[model samples]
Target: MHFLTHNTAPCDSTFSPLYSVVFGCILALGLPLNAVSLWTLLRHHSLKSPSAVFMVNLAVSDLLLVVSLPMRVYYYATGTWPLGNLVCNLITMLFHNNIRSSAFFITFISVDRLLAVVYPLRSRHLRTSSNAWKAAALVWLLVLVINIPESMHFSKFLKELNGSSCFPKTPHRSPLHYIQPVLMFSMLAVNMVCTALVSWTLSRRLNDSARVNNKVNVMLIFFLNLVMFIICFLPLSVGILSTNIHVRPLICLASVNCCLDPLLYYFCLDAFWKKKEDVDLPGEQQLKDIRSPCVGLE
Candidate 1:
């Protein structure tokens, strides 16, 4: 328990209030958003497609992370960890696992879109719902394998006069920490490639107004995914390697992604935002008919 004796006053003073408020906001917004996203995805039979499968998994990851925020909110608001070490470890692991898993699922969504747009005919066999599920399972397995050790390594409780802290700054380093940034960058690279290819493919079809519009919409989704990837995960990746940067803010920033992910669900699944009546009426069915060219490709 010698590691617990180290002074963590600076971290507590800087992060406690900030984390409390930030995490509270995330919980309030993210919980409902992700819950609705999951409900919408599952309700509409959207899981039939590979992209929808990835979206469903992504929503699940966000929900898992969001559900754990209340514990974090209490800890940061009160600056104490009365939940015990086991719960603290679980929470830490959930945070790490979900963030990276969200990235992986987002990358998968981009790649799915890329294949649908850029290599629709050739990549047909690769873009099945079964493959998506298998890929999602692999992502979870890989993330758990990578993060379990790292979470355990860094989740040292800090003893305070009042109580113990769940997550305190530790001077120790782990190889998994280094690997995290590499994995994030590699996923980022994949998103970039997908975005570029999709854009080029769309550019060639600009002569067809309707087709080009649909492809542009598809391209925008990938662009948003790339932007979100850079905004949410890039800072943490950079902070991992740099000594001067505080990771608390980066983590908080990343938490916002849980709220933003529902937007992807809205755009990717046409039925997500549609009302029951709107979906059923023949007059209003034109909305569904304007499907993306990449719709059935996945």
Candidate 2:
């Protein structure tokens, strides 16, 4: 619970310590690693490839989320929404947009890799750094547009009822309750489908030994996200129908997402972070040999 979550102030001396510790840990891990990921992708990798370009933007999205966490930390500690409406709106927008962008871009990254492995020659034409940038820009623009209604929907002040500041105190008759779940689940479904397709394509390309290793590593990341997406989202999406408006379950699930998110990101694209020089395994020697000609062309 946050210190300043309105409706009911999220400030129990008992729980505040736990919340502080969690956010502090996330701030520590997300900032440095996201910074390094940003640098490695920008300066150390071949951005000529779309996957590399998308990876750079993905790191950027995560870093943006990381940057905003401190505000939440402050809010949790002080138990105040002192930032006002404008800052709160920007914070909300940034958080949601980053979330949408991350999920979509992960799918895009998977597709990029699948395309490269499945149809190298044809895919090469469509995969360029500049084009990747355009796609990334489009994602931000679209997600921002999708989230615009949210900014309008949220209220910074309640009518003396001591309600939540970040969320509106509008009547239950308002449409946002339905709209929010629909939007979230739609995005989730799109991501799941895209990931499945990519996984299938990639699996087809892997030889027996490579297949086993890839399944172990890649599925570890993918399925964890899939599982969490289901369990965490169930309350936010499905519990709307239930009369019990218990926010604690949803809050707990949401925190799980944040805590596990770093691990998911680490493994999902960790292979790309490895430079050409990092390998010693004989299994991947075949891949290097196959790509040596393309490497030389660079």
- Clashes per prediction? 0, 1
lDDT of 2: 0.56
TM-score of each: 0.82, 0.70
lDDT of 2 by residue, 31-120 (tens): 887787677655656566676667677777777877877766665555456666677667656765665666667556656654554455
Q: Ten residues in a row with the worst lDDT in model 2?
A: 289-298
Residue 63, model 1: Cα distance from true site in angstroms: 0.4
Model 1: residues with Cα > 4 Å off, grouped in runs: 1-11, 155-163, 169-172, 206-208, 269-290, 293-298
Report the C-alpha lDDT of model 1 over 1-298, residue by residue, as the tens digit. Answer: 4335333543544337678998999999999999887887677664667877888899999999998999888877765577776777788778878878999998888888777666665676787888999999999989878876676565543223233556654323567777777888899899888878867766664457765676667666776777677888877766767766657777888888898888776664555544232221122232334355334322
TM-score of structure candidate 1: 0.82
